[model samples]
Target: MTATSPTPSVVSSVSTLVRSPAPAGLVGHRRAGRSPAPLTTGRARRARRVLAARRRPADRDFRPDIEGLRALAVVAVVVYHAGLALPGGYVGVDVFLVISGFLITRQLLKSVGRGGLRALPTFYGHRVRRLLPAAVVVVLATTVAFRFVGPPLKVRDVATDALFTAFSGLNYRLAWVGTDYQHMGAAASPLQHFWSLAVEEQFYVVWPLVIAVVAVATRRRHLRLVLALLVVGVVAASGWASATLTPANAPWAYFSLHTRAWELGVGALLALAAPRLVALPRRLAGLAAWLGLAAIAVAAVRFTDATPFPGVAAWLPVGGAALVVASGCGPRVGAERLLGEPLVQCLGRVSYSWYLWHWPLLVVAPYALGHALGVGERLAVVWVSLVLAIASFTWVEQPVRLLHWPTWGWIGTGATLGGVVTACSALVMVLGPVTTGTGAAAVLASVDAPGAAAVTVAPAVAGTGPAASAATSAAEQAVARTVAAAVGTVQVPSNLTPLPQDAADSLPPTSRNGCHAGFTAVSQGDCRYGDLTAARTLVLFGDSHAEQWLPALDQLGKAQHWQVVSWTKAACPAARLTVDNPSLGRSYTECDTWRDATVARIGALHPALVVVSQSENVASSSVVPQAFSAATVATVRALRSAGAPRVAYVQDIPTPGTDLPGCVATHLDDVRPCTYDRSAAYRYPDRHAALAPALATASVPVLDPAPWLCTATRCPAVVGNVLVYRNESHLTVPFSRWLAPVLAPVLTTTGA
Candidate 1:
């Protein structure tokens, strides 16, 4: 719908279009239509003036009950989000949406009757006053809390999110993150409230224009017809889109203007049709209201985080809200009385502030404490949110909206907000990296190590000759001589060189670095060196999922005397075929370019062996295993054709769980209880099945490590006192070291 054009002539003609008042007599109760006895003639005229001051030609008496309904909606939202035993409470947002549409449409229609259906600036001014004050206060407070208390990763992520909150795009962001908000845990964002605000703000931007266009186009001739068409169109479009998209596409469906339009349209329809609908008998109206409340309550109790949302499921709350709006006060029924009770009405009055304050409190509280909230902590957060909401409503929101602040005052407010954001951004920019802590740094460092540990094996007893022993002695002597020369002319001790500082630092506290070529410092003679200084270099590559095997590789390196160089990037799998590079601002580039270069360099050095893996978990689009197999076949053929020998491909480990860290953390106390659903973990079994053919065609020996890692029933957590994995699909250092004995036999095999 197009916006209402703001022409000077239209503004001047506003007063000429006022409508006549509604019929003076109440059709039902005799007491309803009668005015309260006038105190005096002067007082009566003042009352009339007050009525006239409402500024709408067809303006009816104020309905404070609607405000009471708003309070109910906000309370439901707050309570459900607080993890109270109310599931359907989130539907309150739908209630508010309908309410907003009704109120906004009513105001616009009243203005149209008095003036000439065009006052875009005045409408915007009222909205700015109504919303901005409370929004700004909440956003500022959330930003401050985030800067000091949030986790390093979250702090960095939410800086952008806070900006989205300020601009009203939070709904989009939340949707993009996926709907399993509860599972996100510490990773859950702070500016989640922006989703509802986004719906409202988006509505405000478009609804006024639609109203103006319809009012002008038909001049109220076919307004109902036009409104009906709009509602049907929006509902259809939203339903179609929601059904077609995956859960990952929730943001586009939930946050986009098209999908959310029907909700506001329902509200708009209510405003235009309320007079007729409200004429029903009070008993029936009351029944409808109670039924509506029941629907909303039921939804709250039954809905869980996994529920497919804002699709057909959204109808429960929307329908409930529509019923309440149509019902008004019922005859002989206590529903209206229950809703209009002082407590409910008061909550409705301050509901806006409550909505603004609750989420930030919930998000920041647990983060500040460095833990997720237990039941008690979540309740405390809820209480604190209520207190803050009430205070903001009373002290900041109400005052700013009521006061006649000058243009300069608004400018000053904007500047203050801008300054606050800029300062927070600067603080985050300066401190974010420093606060990411030593953990990530250590992880990256360990990831950069050259190879696993190297061990010297004795010659075979019977058939093997002294030639093998002689060759081994020569290699050991060469390593010792190189160390002696590098450190000065002193005699080098066996296993004397230190592991790379990065690798050592990167390993977890429980890990023991074995004697490898790079490590030299010894405290208690526990091997601390990574064997990166081997005669041959073997590069390990793939996504973070694949890179998790560093510990195992380190163990293998010590046994085989092979350098395990890692060229891994998060979310990137090793493949010879081209795929999109999201970070590179390019598309369809080879995923294995870095690995290829490393292979060329290693080939030039002519290492005795080359080992490759990452055949599984590659992007389907890249046909990763096939590409990797082709590359390996070419490399092996090139090497074999050159008379070089010994190249092998290791099959990838099975993914343990969908969100390994969260699952493990959640079930940390459970023993003999860890479980994984293999179906959920693997989206493409066919792709995994396809890898075997490629590996066979390449004629490379495939090392299936799954049997070593998984058992008959499950992939157990511990293997010989070492945690099998540090995360979802990666091996812990201790576990990798444990695999050293098993891997040694495989590495020494001669043929492909």
Candidate 2:
């Protein structure tokens, strides 16, 4: 009896793609018009054929040229990171991504054909063998090296980083931490490359599921549609996210699986559509490949560390990779040819091991040797990395993958990984709290100050508690008593010219209670005894770095008896230009607008003085030069043209350390830790000199307080038991008040 049933052609086609090796004669078959048969068929005979195809020898031999491409990528990345001439070498990662996607997918498709669409466990087992052994060895070595050579803070950081690496969450962790790969800190941790590994693993976990779903739903006919949607969706999403986010947000988008999926997807699409894509002429393919390489190079050179990244800027590398893959002549031209060289291919063959070893060596070598490496030392690090990569790839990676260990080997590997993770976790938990330091003593001391000594001070009778209080009370009582005596003693006949009651009542209500009136009574508030009734009012404006000197201004205002008004915001420097502040939810357009408004308001009041100071923390090579130039010109023109008698520009205070707060924290145990290396602090010698020229051109006098603060030895943190600065750059209130004695002279001379 013959039985007929609907056949599954789709299933048969997939089986053929997976089980059968690419034919050696297929290279010659390229010119032939005969199409390859679909892989799937719902029959016992076809299933047997699929299984038989697996035993056939691979006709298209393994290409060493691909390894050469890998070599080029890693070399470029290593050299670029080491501060060499190859700026655009970072794009090599894109090339690696494409290669990884193609190989992994090809293997998975083959598995699907033999097993009838499900073999996740076996697939993951292969991944474990291929990736885990080398990774485990590298991480273990890095942990030991870091403990000895890294700083205390960095040791703590890298330990946490190691845990993330183990779980394949390193990419997200790095994005959250705002790590800058190019211009890393002196105490930078060694495990940063784990970010890329995390991205790859995440892609692996999801990509198979996606392929499985598409295969089961569409069979073989709609495979191209699924690939197209995935590639387009991921690419568009990444591009959009990149354009909108800040530089700080770029890494999260760039490194995460959700963002980088598109690059891998392109490779997968090319594999599934290889028949059509591979039809291009050899010359055309070569040109496209070279063009891709050029685009990648351009991006690396032009992009700076501060450039907003992983947005539209990422297109150059990702697109270049797609071109190289589609061109199918990576064996012939440009980066491909360069990478295909014997030496280059050898490096490529061991690229994974090389990547794992290089970063840690570069990070730890300088510290183990007790100083940063010069050019020669850097070369030594590169050589050592290459040697280690070779050793690791040969000994650990190769042997582990080739040897088919029993279940016992799996158990042993699992236990070792678990023990390492547990030990690292315990170390971090034990050390985290020990680092906060003893701020309790400082806090207790502050609570014991004289003002806080008596929380419940009895209200003094007629203000006679102390000599200072008595003198202040006497003045208030005299004014009140005089006004009171006038009220009763002068209350005379019908109309004695309406006795100036408003003038009599000008003394505040506090005067009736025998307390000081007006600003003198409100001494705790930032106010002084000044002519509030005066026609002219002067407004002092700037950031806390500027506002710290309020005592100096109060003293000057008191002496001159001029009305001093103030409007200040902490850490908000006045700038003529606007930039987006991700924290504030809008562009900072108001700083300059406020400056103009303040000037106009002051002009309306016809003030004798308009004092402004902004101690901006500007790097030597910044846009500040242009911003400052414009601000200086505008300020000078505004003050001079507005008819104010004087406009004073206070110079910036000295920054105590290269990093202000970190420097303070690092030196908490040191008596003279504030002494920084001047060469490190001053990159632009001309910045200070340039300021003088700009200030000289201004109609206002530029007041420089550097001479008073700096000495030959260094800028001391404490002077006469007073902390010169509470933090890094701002003067403590006590210190600023103490400076009144010295600064009083400068104010007098400048005012004159």
Candidate 3:
């Protein structure tokens, strides 16, 4: 979404627009009473005369066009977040960056001309007054609201995100976590929209300092030229970085100020060239403005979530915004008149507040209402957000901005510091303990829960000797005890394995040690696990689905005395199919390359048995189950051909289709609500429906673990005191470890 902290009266005072321009930073001043006198120092006069000579027939200080652009940008963001049809609507953020760059830089330039950066305190004070208070209010409100609707784990995340947002470092936090998906499998943070505001605030930190340096280093006559060169340098360098990093590192490219500075630089360049731009022919300027609007429209309509953002595609909206601003150098014309309309101007006036309020409502409303919102419901949310935005603007943003206490910037800073402290307190209270508790074995033993033993108790050997029969009976009796223990009213155990807050970090050792490759890495990278010195070798292979099974295999390997070697990569399936990588926003050729190399490597190892598992949900919609089944067959045959004496496909686990940890936390007293229907979990995209029969025909032997993890009709998120799944699909490491005994017999019978 797009957002910029606008000057207090930029659009709110539109009714006061006049032909005679006010002081540079004093346009549309209604609450502040009288406008400041125009800068009249010799240098300021010279600069004014130079600009006045190039001005068009009619020019005014109030830019209704800019205000209208803000409204358009904010509306696009709100619509996009509301799950409307605007896929490319996020470009509005790019437009906002440019606007912020232009306006803030122009103000700084005026200060430089008038008194050599002497108004720095006042400049900073105005910014702090304009942005921080509203941001802090929205962040606090979102965090408190989330505590009730969101699960404790997710609420803790929201609080932590709020803490970062309060200090204008939410962008950095998001960059570190990669949108909380690649690492945690958590829901989108309610405060995620703060990243843009953080970017803008960060820009303010550096841009003004650069202007001061330029003003100090250069003579007054040469100041503009030097600053222009610096702005161009920033644009080119940051633009290149954005394009280069987006392919492999979209989170960093999208959120980092270093990559996004160029959009603001483009605005600064426009402000620097304002005089020459105003001198353009009226007809040409009108055409340029129309073209700019079309460019923004095209980007908004054409882009999708899959687009690698803030790269080359971003130029479309950034340039469009710049052209719009350049056109505003003269009089309103063509599309400018439409942008300057009263309604649009009003939207622009409340745009910052609207942006701050919209995302959290959109994110939190679904859970609060206990259902995904339909279009009508979503539209209702948008309207409610609008009302909140207007209220916030009228009451919070405006009043704080108009308050003129001496050392107000310092007061704002202190208030921001207090907000940060408040957020930290919320974070600590919500997160509670960071412990994952005991392992599954300890938990199952102490709680007398069945765990995998509930299903592993097979029927007694019908024809076996007395000793064998007695052993079977003893096993049956042990399972009986497990059943008895599991029969009581199920409540969340005090010693829950991988406590809710620590669930996401409960990964297997392979993941912790970097054995599983990330998206960019093609090589499997030293992924050997479980008794590396054992004579016989077993290979475990595939994507994160395969990685989830590593804990079981690692435990089984030590018990059975075999070397377990794993080759896993994020989002890369074992099936030989061209798939899309959402993070990279393109075909995962790296997966193909990694698969080819891994298959070759497995062939050379000549493993006794190869175990394969992959999440079926990863394939793009274009990839039919038939094709996926065929690809699975090809992969199995290839593994055998590569000198794997035996190959077995593990039935992928039942996906709960909801955040399991969150659901568990929400229903700590009763986890039945977190259960998913058996048939649905094993349906088409699961690959088991198609691939199981296909593999059976090919004699590859698909081992279904469904019985171990599910009952006949449903799979509970928590099974016998162990949190079975970390997220919707992935197994918690503790649960994986607990399944070792049950999984060992089935895997061993495969004849490794």
TM-score winner: 3
Report residue 284 deviation for candidate 2 (angstroms): 4.1
Worst 10 residues of 3 by lDDT: 459-468
Q: Which candidate, 2 or 3, has the higher lDDT?
A: 3
- Residues 1-111, candidate 1, lDDT per residue (tens digit)? 101332343222222212212223222323477778847987875554333322212224444456767878888888888887676677778788888877887887666
In order, the Cα lDDT scores of the candidates are 0.55, 0.54, 0.74
If the candidates were sorted by their TM-score against the true structure, best first, what order would they fall in?
3, 2, 1
Tell me the TM-score of model 2. Answer: 0.62
* Over 4 Å off, model 2: 1-61, 112-117, 179-187, 219-221, 243-258, 278-309, 327-341, 405-419, 425-572, 578-615, 619-651, 657-674, 677-713, 717-752
Q: 563-660 in candidate 2: lDDT tens per residue?
A: 66664443345444444433222344445455566556556655566666765553225555655656655665675566665666666666664333
What total of clashing residue pairs does each candidate reach? Answer: 30, 11, 0
Q: Give the TM-score of candidate 1.
A: 0.57
In the range 1-752, model 3's lDDT, one tens digit per residue, is: 11233335533443333222323422221356776567769767554444443343222445778888999999988888888878989998999999888888888888754456676777777777777777777877787777767656766677778777767888999887873334645568888999998998898877777777677767566777888988889999999999998876788899999999999899989888875676665676788889999999999999998878878889899989988889778644698788967778778888998899889999998989988899988888887777677668777887887776776655567576556757564765655433332223323552223334433433322122231233233324343344344434245666776777667788878777778888778995657778888898889999988889999899888878889998998898899987877666667888999998999999999988899999888887677878899998899988888877588777687787777777667666665577777778854544456777787667765655565566556666655666777777789997787766645544565666
lDDT of 2 at 520: 9
